[model samples]
Target: MRTAQPRHYLMCRPTHFDVVYSINPWMDPRKPVDTPLAIAQWESLRQTYLSLGHTVETIDPLPGLPDMVFAANGATVIDGRALVARFRDAERIAEGPAYLQWLREHGFADARTASIVNEGEGDYLLAGEWLLAGTGFRSDPRSHAEAQEFFGRPVIGLTLVDPDYYHLDTALSVLDEKTVAYYPAAFSPGSLAVLQRLFPDAIIATDADASVFGLNAASDGYNVVLPHNATHLIEALRERGFNPIGADMSELLKAGGSVKCCTLELRSAG
Candidate 1:
């Protein structure tokens, strides 16, 4: 049976949430965005974490950074050390320094901005002692080496093939130290082979679930929070002894993010 663990997370309110420019397949400038509704949805996520005994910390939202609500892209925090992101898109360039400053001011003395293009936890996820790094769209391949050096973990590089799953967090989620849930088609043949060798018993998501950002869920060892529309994944998670909590990230999904996108786990050293 899976046991729940209390986690610490960093979040940013969707105070200025909007899709003024398109960066991914899910975003469109012509689509109407309701800032208030986005905030409400984000709040529900934060509250869900709080009710589950997870600590939630917030960073003030900058007016011009509409995508700031997707806090998981800000930085990768492990053992109290942070590697801030260097965004691939010019639209998110300033986010790097903003996240760096937050880390520095918030007691992360070992934090430093990444020299190469990498969108923080959006591409870097920790599974046991392995650091799963993703590239092909947002993060550069070289950043994988940098993350290995910074975090002192064996980095396993994975290539994302689908544009819809631009970030690794969008196509895969680390369910626990030893298990993960992913959509196989989003990865390249080589990456898929690597995953199969590494996690022979991983939970596989269908196209119907992955299409609704289901793989972007977050797990606290036991409870998996994902998009409500991802019905298949919900049942799959339950069959594996996980408590699946359905969340409504429809408003946020318009910009290519859901639960995991809004939550950045702050892993500290023992």
Candidate 2:
């Protein structure tokens, strides 16, 4: 198989009911949330995406899973080849099946998880023949190799050093057709060398930037997704001739997710 990278991501719409620990009473959680700021952020995120000339698809009446916004967390798409994920987190296992159903309905071949053990989709990246995966924390090694075989790819397993950089999306992303955004410290020395070899001119994010908005959040060729008030990082991105696009994802972060988590691109993702 060839390297598969997303050209566009599928973002869902959020309502009071869709949010984890949402204001809605029906969806059970920590309690009714006072997440007005998160709501505002989501609106701005929608706007920022539109400004970039991309249409945002809303998954109105969002379904099961406590933190389902990480759509990419549950679905792995290779050349439009859909493999619905099976999350280690019980709360999010529902999302993978849901995505699989979508693929079946749309005339696509779908794959399923063997058990309730695979980690979230953010832990994995389809980098060429090697499946760059985060092996510690949320995603484990057992499932990592399993995913490689299922996709007919080699697994370049990377362990997460700390909790903050828990997911691959939080640390690494393809910034453009050639460049990538990454934080080497979060990865093991071997994986760090691997990424550098793959993307020689990659932008290594500052620790401050990664914590602020997840440096490798989302990207569309030269365009990238970031959080609000990322003035400094935005400047750096601009200096690199990148279009730093901001989106509201306060609610997503509250649930341990973000713009990068919200969607998974299918079709010719590269």
Candidate 3:
């Protein structure tokens, strides 16, 4: 893989991260969470992005919104326009306006609320010119059509089937402009075939990698930011000529998210 121009990302400080509610299958309210460790891990991820020459911006983490630390679910920024999420879960409903406000306050002049239920970048991933929209879980398939009209980009809707892989980000990752990595079992046979037809040379991750959220990674064409436990994925990326940077986000995994969940791309308009 080759290096591309550094990208800008939006992040939220894990000031109040805790698994207070069980919205996803990964969340366990009975398990004890270490808040300080979570903050430290999140900071390490921020610093890693900075080290790789990427810009990192922040949104204020509101009290009582534990999942706010997973900033990638807040909104999808492309060409300086933000399609803010309309969360499917009531617990996360407030995040829609909160993120839209942050985007507007920042540089996203075109930021607006999404009509259909969606989970922002967690469901809608930008892979080069294509917008890969994940449905059958947190995001509605209708939002894909809306996103196509809003961004004027081709949107491919893929339906997810596995309960553990509730969000597309949990099942798939855009490795570079032309390549991707995904868990084939996470999607329906039709959706898997569609992805295979689209990305014939895409990397196929094993169950082990998918279980650790290895597919939930952020790549800059040259460098991939992923969880520390995904050793196989790191080796795989290295073999493909891309540098793999690892950051421990085990504490945040209690809420069913990892490194990719903590970062949202802020693409330029031009």
Tens digits of per-residue lDDT, candidate 1, 157-248, equal 99999999999999999999999999999999999999999999999999999999999999999999999999999999999999999999
Residue pairs clashing, model 2: 5-269, 5-270, 6-269, 7-269, 13-59, 41-248, 45-248, 73-121
Question: lDDT tens digits, residues 1-270, model 3?
Answer: 388569899999989898878888999999999999999999999999998899999999999898999999999989988999999999899988899999888878998999999899999999889999999978998899999999999999999999899999999999887999999999999999999999998888889889999988999988898887888888888888888888788898999999899999999799
TM-score of candidate 1 on Cα atoms, chains taken together: 0.99
Alpha-carbon deviation at 116 in model 1, angstroms: 0.3
* lDDT of the candidates, in the order given: 0.94, 0.64, 0.91
Tell me the TM-score of each prediction against the true structure. Answer: 0.99, 0.80, 0.98
Query: Which is the winner by TM-score between candidate 1 and candidate 3?
Result: 1
Error of 3 at 215 (Å): 1.0
Model 3: which ten-residue window has the lowest total lDDT? 1-10
Candidate 3 global CA lDDT score:
0.91
Which 10 successive residues of model 1 have the least lDDT summed? 90-99
Q: Judge candidate 3 at residue 52 and give its lDDT.
A: 85
